[model samples]
Target chain A: MMVTLNDARRVIAAAETKAQEIGQPSNIAVVDAGGNLVAFARMDKAWMGSIDIAINKAFTARAFDISTEKLGELSQPGGQFFGILASNHGRVMIFAGGVPLRKGDEIVGAIGVSGGMKDQDIALAEAGARAF
Target chain B: MMVTLNDARRVIAAAETKAQEIGQPSNIAVVDAGGNLVAFARMDKAWMGSIDIAINKAFTARAFDISTEKLGELSQPGGQFFGILASNHGRVMIFAGGVPLRKGDEIVGAIGVSGGMKDQDIALAEAGARAF
Candidate 1:
């Protein structure tokens, strides 16, 4: 089953709480199983440029059903998925902060966060996923 | 000041209420004064294709400080702004369902609605703008 809007809200709330705990304002986004945006939030004073990044990160996570962190590893220079960012109308975000949401063994959706260092963003995203 | 995430939520809520009253599942988006998306929601069973359209409609409204319906009229053949859609990386949506949010005389943001007929979209957008 796809993630519902209520599920997305909970995910976003958890991510926001994590960002606050880390003192990092963030842009958070959720995308459904179909890779369509379900909900998004830009915390006050978050980097404006990160809005697109956050949303695309979620899309990338669900697009391949893999964490964007792993995708980043695979898309490194000379790696198998290198240049993959050139596809999906440039919406493939290859980096941390994108995590797939799972229900039992199936991926239901994804959460993406931006506006912090890689580790911080990843932490926030993981926190969000845990709430799902 | 630009629109905040809280403001975007209120706007989306109003638009969603209007959509429900009219029996239309809609994609709703809100953009701040900088034309950056503040928040977005895709109602259950909403047209997937309209997700992009809804977001861009809000962007187009804020980008030009004009309702997309007005922009559509201007972008028509033989109009002063004909062919303007070719610009903005195809983010310009020249159609109904986009309304600017105003504070006093200043434009602060915009709301966009999709997943319905032109008139219905406009009505929903107007409902959102009214709430702002």
Candidate 2:
């Protein structure tokens, strides 16, 4: 089935809370198993172009089945595609803050937050994810 | 809820299987609730230009709360200033083949695939998504 609106609201709520707690604004995105967007939020003071980055992060996570942060890890100099994403379309954000969603061991969707420091963004996303 | 690691694996597995099944090499992307890159794969014969499109599809999914196909639909005619949006950094592939993830009634993340015809790509991605 498609990702329901209810989950989209939850993701946004959690993102807001985490962002507020961190005192950092961000752009949050949520999509379904088919990689379709279900919800999104661009908080005040968030980065202008971050929406693209956030979405890319989430997309990367779901597409590769790994953490965007990990992509950063592998991106270290030469780890395969390292920067290949950038070369491909130039919107790859290997930094932290992008995460995935699941239902009983199934990655039904994902979330991406942008604007704050990569580490902080990741922490906030993780916090929000755990809350659900 | 977050797109769990399990979801990433499923996305990748399904993508690869579908690509092979279709006799088409493809680039697939999956993002988390946070819009992070969860999983990605570039089939041996997939077009290099397609990777970014695949990931962007997933990213857009998480960022816009809509389908890339729908986004394309909006780009047509004068729906919402159409072409004006393309000015925003432009890598917008409003084509199909991108879908989202959900748990019950929540959108956890999304998935995107590229390389084959847009419709075929979306169909393959959908096949993979349903497998989950």
Candidate 3:
């Protein structure tokens, strides 16, 4: 199944709630199974630069079918995917803040968050993924 | 050969000059023959949202070997290439402000401009392409 706009909205709402709870304005994005953007929101005062980063993070997560946190580890120097970030026309984001949405064993979509510290972004993204 | 950094700078500078003359702060980008970004500049007070658009417009021009303005016409509803924007991982921007850079009938690169109206962006991109 694909990620519907309605599904993306619910995920974004949950991430927004978590961001509010943590007192961090964030940019959140959702991508469908085809890695196309489904929904996005930039909370007031969120970093403008993070808009691209948030969308690409979700694309990277769904493209590789892995959490961006794990991808970041593997993409570090001396790791298997060390140069992968340069492969996707600069769209791959090897960092925290991206989590895949799964339906059973199938990846249905992904969520990405930005405009906060790495930990905060990860937490917010995971919160969104869980909502999915 | 691909577009060199020096050439990209010259193109951006020319575009910036034109933008200044027209009183429109803008985002400008250049891509090499391989469709990789060579350079980019966002003028003071330019819309952050145009950064991605500027870069992708350059990419689209080079990818199609035609101006995005022309492509936009063919991509309109009921046109032969309608719905083409849904391709290219959402990077194909079928709109104004993208112009191919040519050398002796060979397309060597492209320039993209944004953060202004359609005519302004087109004029700015043309200025950059002329420089190239």
**lDDT, candidate 2, A25-112, per-residue tens:** 8888876665557778899889989998888777666666667888788887768766656553665668787787777787777777
lDDT string for model 1 (A1-132, tens) is: 388888999999999999989899999999999888998999989999999999999999999999999999999999999999999888999999999999999998999999999999999999999999
Ranking by DockQ: 1, 2, 3
lDDT scores of the candidates, listed in order: 0.93, 0.76, 0.93
Which 10-residue window of candidate 3 chain B scores lowest in summed lDDT?
B30-39
Q: Best to worst by TM-score, what's the order?
A: 1, 3, 2
Q: Per-residue lDDT of B20-129 in model 3, one digit per residue for the tens?
A: 99999999999977576889999999999999999999999988999999999999999999998989888999999999999889997899999999999999999998
List model 2 lDDT by residue over B64-95, tens digit each.
76678888788777777377356436545677
Q: For candidate 1, give the DockQ.
A: 0.83
- In model 3, which runs have C-alpha deviations exceeding 4 angstroms? A1-132
- A48-115 per-residue lDDT for model 3 (tens digits): 99999999999999889999999999989999999998887889999999999998999978999999
Interface DockQ of each model:
0.83, 0.09, 0.03
TM-score of each: 0.95, 0.52, 0.54
- Give model 3's clash tally: 0
Candidate 1 RMSD computed on C-alpha atoms after optimal superposition onto the true structure: 1.4
